[model samples]
Structures are given as C-alpha cells and as structure tokens.
Target: MKDLTILCGVEACAIFQNSFPEQPTIWPSVGEANRIIEKFRSLPEFERVKRMINQETFTEQRLKKMEAMLKTQQKDNRHKEFTQVIIQRLDGSSAILPLKTDDDCVELDNVINQFIKDIDRKMEILQNEGSSSNPAPQVS
Candidate 1:
C-alpha cells in the first residue's frame, strides 16, 4: 500500500479499482506499479483522461484571466495599425502589398480585378485555338 502510494499519488488503493477496472490496480512492488502506470500512459484513454482534467481545470476564473490577457494584448496592438494583402502566384512567387489607407485597398482591388480579366482573356484564347485545331465532324 505504501509502495503503491510512492509509485502513484496518494490514496492509490482507494481509487485504483475504479480508475483501472480492466487492469490490476494493486501491484506488489513500486517498480511493478510504475511499469503498469507507464503502460497505461501509452493508452488513448490516458490522453482522454488528461484532456478531461484540463477541461475541468478551465474554470470561469481561468476564462476571465484569459479574457483580461486578451484585452491587454488588444490594447497594446491598438497603436500599430496596418493591413497586408498577400498574393501568391502559380509560379511559386508571392507579393505582399502593405495598405495604410482606403485608397490603397481600392487600388489593390482594381489590380486583382485586372489580373483576373487578363487570365480570363488568355484562357479564352487558348480555348478558341483548341476548338479551331479540332473542328466538329460534319453530319453528311
């Protein structure tokens, strides 16, 4: 019993049966108990139990603490305001457009629209060339 307490936490004997019903909860030696604990730690149920403990620990007080921390971070970021638009091309090249004003955003939108139009025109040209090369069969 004392060895079980040393290997596991306190009250090892009391909660052992309920905690691990399938496996033998009471081990004769501390080393054996430690091996069993290690074996159980590898199990998925161990991870699920850890997650449940974590979820249980996240009380309202912890949430308030997190909210306060977030508010402080937001206050810190209020002074520095900038927007970045990332455009990733098919050629594995990327462009980052930094926008500080409404006019800059509008310009970016126009550029994107123009680029789309250019791509559409190129696709149309390719489609027309393909159709011309392979004409439809005549129904004689």
Candidate 2:
C-alpha cells in the first residue's frame, strides 16, 4: 500500500485543515494521520505533501469506514411497510414527519456516494497543485 503521509507533513496537513475548516471533506483523525506519517517516513517531505490526499489510496478505506458507521446506526425494519409519523406543535405552528421508506434509504445511499465523489474531486485539485516538484521562484 502507498503511504499517504508521504504526500504531506503534519504541519502542511494542519494548514489544509485550517484552510478549509467548514469543508465537508473528511479529515483523517490524529491516529490515522500519525500512522500515515510513520508509514511514509522514507519519502521526501514535499512528495509526501503532494500525495497527502490520494484518492486511490484512501477512498475505499474511507467508504468502508463510513459504511460501518452507517451500519451501526441502521435500524432493522423487517416488518411490513409502514410510515412513521412525528407531530410537533408550537404556539402557532404544527409539523408532521414520516419514517423513511426503502426508496429513501436508496436515495440516501446514492447521495452519500455522490458526496464522496465530490470530496475526491476537490482533493484531486489540491493534490495536483501540491504535486509540483519545484517551488515557484520568489519575487524580490
């Protein structure tokens, strides 16, 4: 397996986190980051940063992790089809909600997949920009 830490140092990764705080992308946890850093320690520092967010390396792992989380939260709905409704009342307002159906679950799954794809697209842009082996010359 290719080590991702080789793509970016901890400081550079930190800068990326700070630079995009609100972005929906998943930031690797500290332990994960540390492991990646250790694994790729042999690579040059700049090369590591360039490959920091390699999709081919992390995408499947991340998807599986996300799937596990979703599984833990999943409800067993073996019963016959039904609609779950929630009602709410306020001083001057009322609202109602229904439980998700099979279609809803499928739609949500598609959305999650698409969301991952979007994150990959963003990471690709960052990776390409970072991959330059030479630093641009500084202006006087």
Candidate 3:
C-alpha cells in the first residue's frame, strides 16, 4: 500500500473502531484523537482495530482538506510536534506509539502531529475565506 495518512481525532478513532469494527476512517481534529487515547487508557487491555484504505473510507474533499492543512502546518510554527500516532492494522487492531523525533516516526508518523495542527488551521482559513464582514454591492 502507498503512504496513506488519515486525518482523524482520538475520540473519533475510538468511535470508529467501536462502531464500525470494519472500515477505517481518520479523524480531522486533535480533540477526537485525544478522546481515542483516553478511551483506550480506560480500557483494561489493548483492542485490535482494523482500517480499510480506499475511496470508500475517505471523501475526495476531505483528502484535499488534509493536503491544504498539511501546507498550512508546514508554514506555521505553533504546532510543530506530536507525542504519538495511532497505527491501525488491516485486521482491525491498533497501537499508539510515541513520536521521539523525525527519525522515530519515519514518514507517516512524522506528519500525524502536523496534520492535527493543520485541521483547525484549515477550518479557520476556510471559515475566513467564506465569510465577509461587509457585503459589497455587485459590480455586475
């Protein structure tokens, strides 16, 4: 499989793992990711999670949003590091690993934290781009 990065949150991860138990979906916010970690910590043992990498799992728009967020993250310095990333296997099992450094997380793991930072940044950009404080008269 190619490099597939899902932009999802911790809570959404838990919900998706618990609810779907078949399809894998990435959450697009830090809040959701935190929730998933918390859920797992509360659990008695680690749960195996499965994630399917395909069009059915993610929308084109969402993917584009992730790309945009990535770009935004690259430019911003506020959020440049992440502690961990959750890796889900094809069989529906998952593990959370700490991100020690760029060397520690190779490719996908390196981007996980930046992706989280970009989610909100992308949303903020989208929102600002869509809204206008004052409605101007049409020149046409």
Candidate 4:
C-alpha cells in the first residue's frame, strides 16, 4: 500500500510513502475521517467496549478476562477509540479479520494511526492545491 507524505525534511524528498504511489482518492474521505475521529474521541471508551462485547460474548467471565488482561494497559484512554475501529473493521464485512487479542488490537492501532496521518496530509495538500493559485510540489 502507498502512503501520503505531507511533512518532509529540508530536502523535501525524505518522506516515504508505500501506499499512495500515485495520488489520493478523489473523494471527501479525509475531512470526513477527521470529523469521525473527533466524534469518536469525544465519546466514552465504554461505548466502544459495549459495542465490542455486544456482538461477541458479553459474559461476566469474558469481561473479567479482558479487564484483568488490559488492566495494566497504558492505552485505556484510547481503548474505546481503538476498539471502535476494530469492531467496525471486523464486523459486517470480510475486509479484515476480527481482533481476538490485545496484541492484535495494538497492531491495528498502529496501522490506523499511520493511515490517519497519511490521509490527513494528502487531503491537506490537495485542498491547498485547489485553493492556491500557485503551488509548489513537495518532494516525496
């Protein structure tokens, strides 16, 4: 997969992207993504937790199992957010496999973070190009 590199070094050629070797999607996906993430960030983590547990096993035993395992996590604040993404990707679609462990969740979080940064940068550049009469190409 190619990625979008908005910020670059002084050389403007050091930013590497593997996902977006060509151009970005010609849609309003970035701003919508930012808005969605903003809304997700504002919600309580428990909301995602409930959503995850809803379609899966919500037994007290299972909850305790996950709770104890995640008790020492430093990502409690981002848990719901990460969880929401996991569920959305895993459920009602065959695009991605479901996250069954904390490790999977971590990996997914990293992937999502990179995607978010890349997309936001791409959208920024595209928007700037659309509005600016003169645009300088950023080395990638």
Best by TM-score: 1
- lDDT per residue (tens digit) for residues 26-121 in model 4: 223556556655666677899745534443466776888888878747455355556566567667643454568888677677867877898899
Among all windows of 10 consecutive residues in model 3, the one with the lowest summed lDDT is 1-10
- lDDT string for model 2 (51-134, tens) is 666777699889999998776555333111112111122233344423267766664455456657988999998888887756
Q: Each prediction's TM-score against the native?
A: 0.34, 0.26, 0.21, 0.28
Q: Rank the candidates by TM-score, best first.
A: 1, 4, 2, 3
**For each candidate, what is the lDDT?**
0.62, 0.55, 0.54, 0.61
Candidate 3 local lDDT, residue 14 = 28
lDDT of 1 by residue, 1-140 (tens): 67777877743322255654485456555676677667656769867476344554778669899999998886444322211233343345564445677866765666667668988999999999999999999999
Greater TM-score among 1 and 2 belongs to 1
What is candidate 3's lDDT per residue for 6-74, written digit by digit as tens?
Answer: 334223342245565586544554586677667667665434234324575578768889999987886
Model 1 accuracy (lDDT, Cα): 0.62
Give the C-alpha miss distance for residue 68 in model 1, angstroms.
Answer: 51
RMSD of 3: 25.0
Clashing pairs in 4: 1-18, 1-19, 2-18, 2-19, 2-20, 3-19, 3-20
lDDT of 3 at 130: 70
